[model samples]
Each structure stands twice: as C-alpha cells, then as structure tokens.
Target: MNRLALLLAGSAVLAVATITPASASTASAGEVDTVTSCGNSGLQSGLSTRLCAEVTGTTVEFYGTVGLAGPPSPGGPGPAPKELITTLSTEVVGSGAAPTQQIAHVLFTSANLQVRGSAATVPCGSTVRATFGVASFPWAPRPVAHEVVITC
Candidate 1:
C-alpha cells in the first residue's frame, strides 16, 4: 500500500476507536461526529448504497457499501454484475476537507466498497460537508454521489 493509504488506514483504526460522547471539556479532541445516508433514489440499479463518515478529532474516517437493494442477507449474493469493472474509483470532497480543495481518490475492486480515508485538518465546529462518490457500475447510468453534512 502507498504511504497515503497506509496512513489513512491506520488513522481509521484510531479515529473509529476513539469516538466518544461529547464531553463538557473544552479541550475536546475526540468528540464524535457522524452521518449516514442509505436507501435513497439518488442511487441506481435497484442499488442499496450506504455512506457513512465518522469524524473524530481532526481525522475523518469514511466507509460506503453498494449492493442490490433487497439482498437475501447482509453482504449476500446480489444480482450478477452486468459488466466487469476491473477497478472502481471513489473519493470524498468537501469544504475545508483539504487545504488545496483537492479530493482524494481511492480505488476498489471488491463489492464491499467500504473505504476509509482522512482529510485535511480543520478546527472543531467548522461545518464539514462532504460528498462521497462511487464510480459508475453495471446497470447504473452514472456514478453515485451521496452528500453528508456534520460537525466535528
């Protein structure tokens, strides 16, 4: 894995683990900020897509899932992919998300599509608005993008 991916992956473990209820202390560094969106019409192909992001401290950890809407079971076999996409691309972009305002693209080959990455540091209480984009897939007219807004 590249350095950036490795760093973000490692940070995910800590960010997800350190989440705690907001405390009264002003020295807050790990208060949790989270958001999830799923089962919406914005998706295609009868797809059940879920986007979640947990921001703890100055780190942002995100994960997403894509599968048929009514799978027999969680992560169960969904309809066969109508087309073979060797690589699927995804990213998280938002205001105050990056210093350069550039999005980070992460590649995936698995259907799980669950990914996590850290973004640029911003002060607490700064409105963090992000759009999680999943590359177009089989039977989908275009890529799917889900917007999430939360405070960190």
Candidate 2:
C-alpha cells in the first residue's frame, strides 16, 4: 500500500509540472533601445529635433514633457500664470540606406498628458531604426530639458 501511495504522489507531481504554462520568450522591458541625449546640439524652440534609434523585432514608443523654468512676469496681477509648457511628437523612418517610406507619425497635445505615442508592427527581420524630435512653439527664454521616455 505504501508503494502504491508513493507512486501516486510521484505521478501527481509529474502531472502538475506538465500542466504548468511555459515561460514566454519575449524580450524584457530593458531590452528595447533608447536614446536620452543627442550630443550637445540642444533642441531649440520652434525647431524639430530628431530622436533616432535602431529597433528590431519589437515595437517602439515615445514620450516627452516640458517643465517651466521660472515664475511668470511680475507685472501681471489679474491672473496667476503657469510657467511650464510641454509638448511631444513622433515619427518612424525605415532603416534601409535609401528607404523611401515612413512607418507612422503621431502628434500629441496638452490634452493628452505625458504625450505617449507608439509605432507597432515595425519591420522585424532587419535592424529597424527611427528618429523623432521636439521643439517649443515660440522658443521660451529659459528652455528646460524636455523629459523623454521610450518603451518596447
């Protein structure tokens, strides 16, 4: 009877292992490529800068934010002024040396906080690459570093 019981226990353990779901092989959050800074050429106001990176076999997304530098003008009295102004935009360019097609373009507005945009189903086989840029409308006197984020 003890031998039968031991066999049953072993069989149950094997059954459980077989039924368990296997771990997925997809890439982790950190595997995606990201670019935080581009040399010393700071992004100018009213000018679009390029955020470029190579991405293969995964989707890529972009995010940005603008922070105010200082308080509003002192002369103003009627309305309290807000300092920081933020905006973000994104576009995907193919990787080939002479590629002529754009994968996607996304525009984000203040209404959409955090300015999250994404391009999915990008060419997966080769080393896919893309570039995006950001700029202010009227060029703020004290420009702040715009926070950018990316995910795959």
Listed in order, each prediction's TM-score against the native is 0.42, 0.30
lDDT of 1 by residue, 32-126 (tens): 65444432334544455555555555555445555545535667664454332222222334442332222334433335445444554555555
Over the stretch 1-152, how does candidate 2's per-residue lDDT look in tens digits?
99999999999999988887664445577564444442122343432233333233355444443222334447865222222343333333433345222232333322222334454445444333333334334455222222222333
Question: Runs in model 2 with CA error above 4 Å?
Answer: 1-57, 69-113, 125-137, 140-152
lDDT of each: 0.46, 0.39
The true-versus-predicted C-alpha distance at residue 139 of model 2, in Å, is 1.9
Candidate 2 yields a Cα-based lDDT of 0.39
- Measured by C-alpha RMSD in angstroms, how accurate is candidate 2? 10.0
- Highest lDDT model number: 1
Winning model by TM-score: 1
